[model samples]
Target: MNDMEEDGRRTTMTTTKTRGIRLAKEENEKTDVRKYIPPLDGQYVEKWLNDSQNPGQVGEELVKQQFLLDLLHSKISARYERGLETAEIDEHAWQVQNSITAIKRRLKQLVDTVPPVVSLETTDSRCIEMYEEKQLMATQGMLRADILEERQRVARLCWQLHNTGEDTKEMVNEDPKNDEQEWVERCKLEEAARSALLEEINRLRSTCADLRARLEMEALSNEVPKYDSL
Candidate 1:
């Protein structure tokens, strides 16, 4: 019975040892995938090689993990590039919009700074009346000046005639005592000078008449006719 009891305990001890070893192996297997290549990092890809079945399988799996990582990296890089392109397009669109707005603002500013040209014609009787009045005043002034100049010229001619008559009367009184020939020659010279002066006065009168006619024609040409306003 003692030997049988010792054998039963030994059998129990062996069974427990076997169960513990199996559990420890399962625990080690749970951490094995992490130790192989870190699943995502390919932690030691160079150290893995196909030397045996186990190593070969690990190498193959590591390569697959590396390929998966590279594929994900490529996907992220492509998305980053697309994002950059989209940002640039948005920025360019914004710049174009700003340029259009600036151009519109500049065009408006240029338009605002320009002055508009328009005709000045008006149908106002008051303006025409005022212009006619100004022309009448000017014509009256010119006529008065010409008449005054003519009057002064007539006065001078009268004075010269008075002097000549006085000299003739003095010569007649001295005719019996002085040379009649000298007196006759002096009268002739005086008459010639008076005739020249008279000619000059007539010429001046003609010039004044022509000037007045010209001024009237010019005023008539520049005059604005009266029209009824609407």
Candidate 2:
């Protein structure tokens, strides 16, 4: 009876060890199957790859991870390039603003230093001196033309008077003293008109010349420096 009891205990011990070994082998197989069965998080990557023939391929996960990494790197690189470009533009804008400010200051100084061309009596008169000089020359020209025309008329009249005097002396018994006095008076009138015309012409010409010289001086004074850019 003792030997039979010992045999039964031994049999029970051997059965328990065999069952534990089988359970451990099944659990390991289940864990390995879980690796092939991708988690929900990786579903999108699987669908994108769409390799239906080998859905459980080991390299699919590695390929998806690499693709995500490359996309992220590209985005980062683009952002960095954009930031650099923006910085350059901002720097250039700041320089432009500074240049504009400096130019404005210089322009103000120019305005203050240069006298205005116009005055109370002369609207648009910055070039008034030049305008007046031109006017004077024009007037002088008109006066000179008039003087020439008058001199021609006076010469014609004098020729007519000489012809009349010679005809009188030949055709009629004339009083010599009376004839001589009339001739002298006629000659004096002609000389006086000629002298007056000549003097007026000379005065106009002189005034015109002086005005032209003054206009040139005023022009030099009015000239101011001009800016093309910065």
Top candidate, metric lDDT: 2
Model 2's alpha-carbon lDDT is 0.56
lDDT of 1 by residue, 135-160 (tens): 55455445545545656766797898
Work out how many backbone clashes candidate 1 has.
0
Angstrom error of the Cα, residue 41, model 2: value is 92
What's the TM for model 2?
A: 0.28
Model 2 Cα shift for residue 80 (angstroms): 86
* RMSD after CA superposition, every candidate: 47.6, 42.0
TM-scores for all candidates: the values are 0.25, 0.28
Stretches > 4 Å off in candidate 2:
1-126, 189-230
Q: For candidate 1, what is the lDDT?
A: 0.54
